[model samples]
Target: MAPSSQSSLAAKPLSEFSFPSPEVTASPYPFYEAMRAEAPVYKYPDRNDYLLARREDILFVFQHPEIFSNLTYLADPAQAGRVLASKPPGSVLLTNSVLSQSDPPEHAVKRRALRGLINPRYIHSCEQSLRRIANELIDGFIHRGEVELRSEFADKLAVLTICELAGFPPEDRDIFLSWHRIGTGHGARFLTPEQRALQGKDGPEQQAYIEKTIAARVKEPRDDFITEVIQDQIARDGELNLPYLTGTLRQILTAGNETTSRLLTTVMKLLIEHPDQLAKVVANRDLVPGAIDEALRFEAPTQWTSRLVMADTEIGGVQIPKGAFVFMLYGSANRDETWTDPDRFDIERPAVRELNMAFGGGIHRCLGSPIALAEGRLGLEIMLDRLKNPRFAPGCEDERENIDNFQKRVPKALHILFDAQ
Candidate 1:
């Protein structure tokens, strides 16, 4: 938590580049500008190692896993030292899931089990279920004509969808949300000092819950994702132990449920803001899929991901020492001019497929991409169909003005006045 020790180097000072401060966390673009202009790969005078801000450099870190390891913050001696030296064994953010912790072979084995159930075919196969879930949530609040969009719609829709896939009961949505909120830090590092103290608090209780669930599934397995993972060859191989199973379930719930919920809220808000974009999509429903991509590009749900260096690496003309930490700024990467217009929100932007780093590319790319896409498309399509006349509410405690953060972008509570279809 001290200033950069390598101040005498040839690099310019990134002292002015503010990090997770209240203002920066609320709206980070201004700080991102300062950092990108000063040093695309900045070594803050008062922070950790190089923080990649420019698109190309951020992509380089995300794409190259050999030099920059995914499990760095959790595995690196310095970071791990700090984490262990603290009250808890882990950091505010986690790297214990198969996607976050393992490299190559182990990652492949665990991901293969998940990928089999989350493949494109399976995603399409679940379309009817997705549509039903979407409508079910919408139906609950449609007659009311007024609802808290985040809690009632986006959050509920995503949690229910993920629960159904993970074989958790619909009534346990609140519990799933509780676990995910604790795990992902909710919107950002908004956890107070006291909250941060509880990072790894309930280890045994959570482990026991997952064990019981896995045991119940083992006794009489259902045709759901939990049974699939529990009975998986990798699970039988002893790779999915108590900690691993608990972590993986947490990952699926948080990564899939939270990100998709935020992203759905983002796109809905975007469409309402840019009525032209919404009109275009309404006129040509085919554009819903492309609009989902555009929404993802415009406002990525995940803003930051960290990687630790395994060997000395050079990226974007900056040399990072072996054991240095690299913060991959996905939000900045999405706006890279080398890929698209950078700022234009064009739903029909040709599918050049510029490799949006929103999902964390390369080996660490989300195994739930298909599920995210499905949820996004289905969720958006349902809103489009149900709410014929949608616009922002006159005044209902707007969280919009203060949401340009590293974690959750867009207003947490989006009050939209929609005409019933």
Candidate 2:
């Protein structure tokens, strides 16, 4: 037979399992293991939603956006309003900038506008600047012999990179990063007490800063991505579509920074856990990208996404009503039986890169994935080059539970003592 259908913890029973439960957030693999077998199309007892626990089922949902719409992300007012309420009024535009939120013709237009700017080729062209930014952050504590790797270096690398690519003034990077923490709903639990206090304070300033930048680009275009994008948008619309541009820029900056940081942190953490694998990658840099991709598959940062059911649908033998929410568990699907060793953290896994839902799949896939991967790979390469024999500090080897949320796995603090050279 295949692996046992019952997880050792299955005694708790599937009905009692509350997702986003602090318990499940801390140790999700076992729970996922049972759900895939026992309840592949599990229904939420508390809400009118369904969670697709199996890989094939989730991929089916991803592929059929006609029946399972991305419109739930922002197009549906009830859902969008619920989400928009949490965000600052300054971020109204941030609600619907990503093309992934829509399907078909409009998605194509949005893709054309922003795809070229954030694509892998464009991101690679900025590698020199990225390298300089990585070295600059490392230079801050490389001589100190120890560093809190996640916050000190990883987060800043992601932030500075987004600032570089978006043409934001480098000095305002702190402002944007601060505002971003509050903007991404999954990020609130990861913030410091000080960061929590600064939440509402930075939104207005960040809004004003973006507005100022937009005006500058409109009046006199500069030799930058933002400027070129603004020129194209104005030509297409005849007048500035302020909300659209604002949302697109914020989405690009938000997703790029947040996802890349989490992925980079996870990549580093996995390497620490498997020294043999880490040695392989460190000795051979070609394995860097594969290592990052494997980390994404092993532990996806953003976990589940809720999609609106456009029409009544049946998935994995379970019937879901139209307009109900279907939560596609990217984390669970990634760990399902699709891989030979479903739970193993193997960087050299052949089927992972093309198939993993770490960045989601099909048309609604993450737009900034190329940038996130590039950043993670380059960020890891930079760290391994500088921080020799990096290992966790005693008693601090494990970080806190994943930010008290089911939606994303954010490793906010991970301190390590490194032989910094």
Candidate 3:
């Protein structure tokens, strides 16, 4: 039988709950259980947003985008204004051209343009390059016998692969990675004023870099995704301009690398902590794909995303007025009691059903999911083959650090030790 609702946690009032608190952000499962049972549609105090924790509510929100709009630029104009203020003058940093923040018609067009670049066939063909990149990353640290996987291997591999695919110069990989970190950190709610200010400077730097890259690609197109985007613009009589192209490129470069790096770190951490699963994966390389899926389900990278209510609606017996924001907790929904042993990190779980909401659903589902999965599977396969008897470095098994952000759940560091092969 399914476990009873956590009645003990139902006593706490919603006003007392904080979404981005350090305690909750570090380990939100307990809070999620409480919210799922006590208040599926929870309103944040002093805010116009609601938190939807139950799986059913989240699914409903995903399916009914007409009611819950993804046009975040329109939904939150103040925030968009602030973001635009950080960019160059006349920049459309928060414009609908960005696939993630756009709505229908505009979203459809932008999604189609990007789909042609990152389609499944393109991702599949990049597997050999991904594997080569993964091996090269491992080669850097194999002789050291101990390495911090996050910075040494995972981060570099993710950024390098994205740079190669985006037609960026190889030497600019670290610069792009730094921009991603700064951009992500700047947007985080839990960051300090100093940190935010430091990160804020990178916004225009990233824009300037992308702008220059787009200009160069337009004049000298190459056999890369950026070239494809440029050709599409020419074919459409220049319907897509520099700002729109840069906005799309920004999303691709950051999201493509950030989420995949987090996945690589999390999956490796899970395997090291669960030796039984690790042994199975090491013995049989074919298990890596299943293991990746299970890891995504167990610890999603992008934890929560919000939608704007286009009309007054009731969800989970609670009335949400029009214009209220609904935050779908993907991390919580993935661990809902609906799944068999939902909390267990079992690689052998049946793959017949949709195991998790990691990549989201509906039309706005992640565009780079195929590439992320391929990169993750190939990275792990190479690691398992090259790293002999890998395990966490001494006293480092419990030193995992997750960024204190409501939207993203990424490990900051993961140290591991293995025999040099």
Candidate 4:
């Protein structure tokens, strides 16, 4: 995973701008800055889709769900058909049952039913368990004086926490990781054909596993999140449809784990890279929460989310016709000019409520946001407190690899050295 040569996107015109190029995926800020400054409503050449870079346009699109619809699963009927064909007949993937992909009455109903799972008290109640998991992870590698934080710490912490909440068996963690990698990886346009073909196999396998879990949960309910969803669905709809249940569970497992894991990796990488900021958080534990928030703004995990333009509309004075895909570049909006010193990572930065599009905006905002923040804050606090003088392992920074995807940006490995405790 050698670093790709940097592209001079600042000098390039907006019409030529293409997302997901290898150089942009590695580091996208320059291109985003150029887009925001020159063409806030630039149309991508390849897809004829719109890419909104400014905070105002991105937020406007997110807030105006009526104009910009989330029913994007149906945007490409042929592609959707192909995806559904690979799954079992009754699979929920056949239809979009996930929170982020639904609209209006259906979205409201599903969100309400799933709301109890991520309620404030519920997320707070998991603190002790989260802390215990964090310490256990640290304990495993504390004696080594060096460890790869991505796989060894962040990945395990995020997946285990979500799995514990979802009532997934600990033994099946690797299987879920594979499902996440393949499901997320293959969808990226940047991957080579060979890579995409290899990664494509995981989707059907994951769907099969989800189907089996739903069937098992139907017969016997447990104290896990999946069981709660099942009971809620039964109570709401009078009967359990395995397809619907599978859709909800798939979103929870993948979204719940992947976002938090990437956040952990980003926060840790930012903190370690900026030792001055890291020192401040180490001195005052209260700053950890702010640091997590700032890190999310600095490097949003889910970079861009798309919405289908239901009808002809004008956004940022640009006339966008119907049948166009509007890409809300969260990473770009997070660093928009509205925030002072947008590029600088500052834990002390004033709270910019509703401005940061990292968790998205409006009704479709991430439901697991509270849980992800709690996990990140707690994980960082425990690690910073336990690991003495942690820094990148010598020469490891050059060897670091980023998950090559335009939608999500995260390090594949973050090797760090610290004093053995």
User: lDDT tens digits, residues 1-421, model 4?
Assistant: 1122243336666555566677787888888878876888988875758889877888788778888987776567986675445433443233445677777866787788787668888778888988998899999989899988888888889988887666877678888776646334214444667667766767688788888998888888777778888888776556666767776787788888878888888888888889899999989999988998888898998887788898899999999998998888889888776777677888888874346689888888888888888899899888888888988888776546566676777886788889877
> Candidate 2, which segments miss by more than 4 Å at Cα?
1-12, 73-98, 180-205, 397-400
Tens-place lDDT digits, model 3, residues 120-207 = 7777787787788888888888999988988888888988888767767779887876773633421344455765777677889989
TM-score-wise, the better of 1 and 2 is 2
Q: Model 2 scores what on Cα lDDT?
A: 0.75
Clash number for each model: 1, 1, 0, 0
TM-score of 4: 0.90
- 24: Cα error in model 4, Å: 0.7
Among the numbered candidates, top TM-score falls to 4
Q: Which candidate ranks first by lDDT, i.e. highest?
A: 4
- Candidates in descending lDDT order: 4, 3, 2, 1
Compared with the true structure, all predictions reach lDDT values of 0.70, 0.75, 0.77, 0.78
lDDT of 3 at 57: 89
Worst window of 10 by summed lDDT in candidate 2: 86-95
Predicted candidate 1 versus true structure: per-residue lDDT over 1-421, tens digit per residue: 1122221211333575456677666656556655765677887564556778766787677677777776554554775665334321332223334456656655665677677558677678778998998898888878866666877889888888887677877897776666524334222234455545554565555566677887788789898888787667444554434455666776676677877888898898888778899999988889998888888877777777777788887887888888777777777766654454456687887752456777877777877887888889899889989977778878765466545344657575888777775
- After superposing candidate 3, which stretches have Cα over 4 Å from the reference? 1-17, 75-96, 180-195, 237-240
